[model samples]
Every structure is written in structure tokens, then in C-alpha cells.
Target: MRRALAIFFVFISFQVSGQGVLDWWDQLHNYPDAAGPDRSRYINLSPGYLGPNAMIMPSLPNMTIDNEFWVQALGQTHAGNGDKTQNFFLKGNFPLARDRVMLYITSVPYETWEVTPETRDERRMMGLGGKGGNTGDVAYGVIFKVFREKHWLPFNFGFRLHTKTTTGGNLTNARSTDNSLYQWEGNFSKTMIEKEEEKLLLKASLGFVTWQTNKNRLPGGSNHNQNDAPYYGFGVEYLNRSWLLSSDVVGYTGYLGNRDYPHFFRTQVQYRFNRLALRTEYNYGLQSWDWNTFSLGVRYYILELLD
Candidate 1:
């Protein structure tokens, strides 16, 4: 009789525990007086819809190309708003026509992330929580530059066409948007001062970007599927034979406003020696984003050209 009573008690305990778990899940996900969970009410289809890389606006590139073949690897950390992310970035530049044209690839190959309880509840409500590690998108582009001395224009003119692929995974964990994006940018730069070992430059950029978003019902009851933005940036850079420093303000404005707009102040410093460089970067998010980020990396030049 004692053995039978023990078995009954174990069964009852399991039943209670299971029900408790179910109730908790329902509290996180269930919607009252609705056909089912209304996901549209929970996710806004903005930058916050996925990971940091989901809808990032491209930063302005310097008019000076690397003039050789080189590759870079970096580790980055982003922390804010009760969430944290760690990721690795890999990039390579290939010269297509010496100093005037190049092709490059930049990739966020892997990341691990964690969100706060409040963030988790929203993700759970949309059935996109319970994720940890995943890969991010890959961007490849072509850059073309026309030197000031060689052209009739007073400033060096450059152009870039970048496209990001939907190679990322783990949408359930909100690790990536799993969507493609495209950008077209025009850049202008002029040398304000020059010496054998030191130089100063002023640069500006304007671009447009478009990407797909989760189909969401707009306030006007219209369903939207894509987002488009116009991006702009301006910066100054100072460089010598051994060191480079730059700072820029970059951002984009989308049609939806608010969370759809993101701006940042970015700064970078680099130290260079024979065939190698050490680099550090910081970005302070402004306007619609609260996350700030830092990164450290090294670049190795596989081939170089000298004048």
C-alpha cells in the first residue's frame, strides 16, 4: 500500500508542475478576445524587430582605397537596454584595378545574444524567442574612385554599391532578419592639408537603402512589406605614416519615423606598421537606438602597392 501511495503522489506532483508551466506560457502569449495570438500588436517591424545587424545603415567610406589586398578580423560587443550581444566580423578587400577600383566583402559570421525578461516576453508573444547562437548577413560591394588631380572636379569622387544577402539564421531567437538589403552611395572628399607623413581630409556621403520587413498591418489598415531610407554622413580624418584617426556622424530616415530612424556618432583609431594594422572603433547610438558598441581588430595586408 505504501508503494502505491508513493506512485500516486509522484503522478499528482507532475500534473501540477505541468499545469503551472502551461499557465506561465499562456500568460506570456495568450491574447484575450482575439482569434489567436495577435503578433501585429507585439512587433513593430522596425530596427528592433531583429538583431543589431538586421537593418544597419552603412557608414561612409574614405576616398582612399587600400591600394592592395588585405583582410581584417574583429570581435565586437554591444550592450544596452538590458540586452547584450557578442559577435565576430570578417572582411576582405581585393583590388580590381589597382588604386581606382576594388571589390570587398564584409560578414558578421557568428553571434551569441541574450535579452531581458521584458524583451523576452515580447519575443515570446510573437513566437520568436528561445534562441542563443546564429550567423548574420554577408555584404559584398564594388567601390570606384576618381582622384581629384586626375579629374576636373575639385574633390575626389567615389561610389559604392553594396548588397547584403539573407544568409543568416535563427529568426526564432531574433538573431537575424533573414532578409536581403541593397544600398547605393556617392562620396566626395578633399584634402585640406598634406605633408610627406601627415594629411587631413574632409569627406561626405549620401546613400539610399531598401530592405524587406515582416508584413505588418499599418495604422491605416494597409499591409506593408518593405522599408526604404535615405542615409547621409560627413566626417573628417587625420592620418600620418603610423596612425589614423576619424570621426563621423551617420544616419538614415525611414518613412515610418521614430524607431525607423537611427543615427550614430562613430569614431575609429588605427595604428599601422609593416603589412599590419591594429584598429579600434566605438559607436554611440542616437535618436531611435539605445545600444552602444565597441570593437577591436587587426588587418593584414597580403599585397601592397607603393607610388
Candidate 2:
């Protein structure tokens, strides 16, 4: 079975050898002036081609209003592709209106990357040439409760509006998109099993996410400069004493066919003691993505900050 699977993958890879995203790559070469502002016009916008923070599908927000701050050390491995990336993610949440509203901000802050010759050559060919370390975009948003759990509905309801800035650097190197992204989603959660020591809850989010794009870069050119798509996420969580476990699948799809659909599965484990928590997370990319990511972090509850 292993041999057959290997052969099958080899055959599939052969079919896409130099197609470079199935003809999209060749099309980029047609415009020799693909540089500066024009760079975003042609390069593949898939998660694999851009920075770790460029195209992210964050999980649904938990409606609890808790003052918290966290930082994570992240590493990404591209396996056979021979690319290594290291970065830090920072996030904080503060209560704005007791249990009704919360404000949050998150950013990749900084990253270092090293790619093999083959990967570098491919990037050079597509106009994203340079490498090394760079900063990532900053995102801020607000989350508010729409309905309290068990108030009128069996589930807790909330809404979130998020916006990403073009604060990231190394655009020519494709480390960032240099474009803005906005997302708004409705969130729902319901507890399924509850005990004195443990409980399970289901969570989901539904909404639209849109980002700036070059219309001419699209196949046959699009009528608009922004690409919009329906984004979604669903997951389950289990909490027992000071431990929390969760798994989720999240993604979004754009109109372009050249690796525009991106999604991934993520699992996280956390242990909390008093006002401090330790966490580790893993993400497996799916659909045109080939990177495996791991992260270790610590979270501190600053409930006294707003208390």
C-alpha cells in the first residue's frame, strides 16, 4: 500500500512538474514589468507562497470576556520543500463592557526564513525574490455578545469584526501581501456535556472575508480590485479542571482557481494554573498547502487589569 501510494503521488507530481500553478506561473512571465506595486498582480496568493501571517483563518471567538495576553513561538517546516520559518505571535484581549464587549489585537510581529536554492529560484522567477527576516501585519478587532447563553436560545451567540493592516514588510520578497483584509462573522457555541470537573462545547463561525487583490492578476481580469469569499470555521472543545483541549477546521475560498482555496486543521492543548497558562498547538495545512506548523506559548490572565 505504501509503494502504491508513493507511485500515485509521484505520478500526480509529474503531471504538475513545470506547470507552476498550472499555467498561472507562465502568465506572470508575460509581463516582464512585474515589480513593485505590480508584484501583487501576478504571484500565487496561496498560503504556501505567502508568509505565515499573510492568509490566516482564525478560529471562532469564544464569547467569554476575560482579560488575557499571550505570546507564542512558532516554527514552520515545509518538509521536502526545504524551507524553514520561525516567528512569534502576540495577542491580547481586554474587556470593554463587562461581559458584553471585548477588544483584541494580534500580530506576527517578526519572522526569519531560509529557503533552499530550488525554492529561492522559483520565488525569483515569480518576482518574489528576497528572503531573511521581516515583520508581519497587525490586526485588531472587536467581539461582542449578541445573545447570552441560555437566555433565550440554548447557545451563546456573538459577533466579531476584524481588520488587518498593511503594516507587514518585505512585499517584494512576498513576505506579506501589503494589502488589507477584513472579516466579520457570527459565532455560536453550545455546551454538550457538563460535569463538576469537565465539559465539552461545540463552536462555529459563519461570515464573509474579503481582501484587496489586483484584478488584472485574475484570470481574464476581474471587474473588481477586491476578492470576496465566504469564510467559515467549526470545532469542538473539552475542558477538564485546569486543562483544555480543542480541534478545529478553518478556511476560505477566493474566486481564482490557481490555489485560491486554503484550509487547515488545528489542534491545541492548554494547561492553566492560577493566572498563568501554558499552550502548544499544531496545524496541518490542507488544499494546496504543504507546511506543518507548531507553536508553544504562554498566556497570562490579567483579569485584575480591568477588575
lDDT of 1 at 306: 59
TM-score of 2: 0.79
Model 2, span 5-71: residue lDDT tens: 9999999898877445435544545544443345446544445566566776665676655544443
Work out the TM-score per prediction: 0.83, 0.79
- Predicted candidate 1 versus true structure: per-residue lDDT over 156-192, tens digit per residue: 8889898988888766455666678888889888889
Which one is best on lDDT? 1
The lDDT per prediction is 0.75, 0.71
Q: Residue 79 CA error for candidate 2 (Å)?
A: 5.7
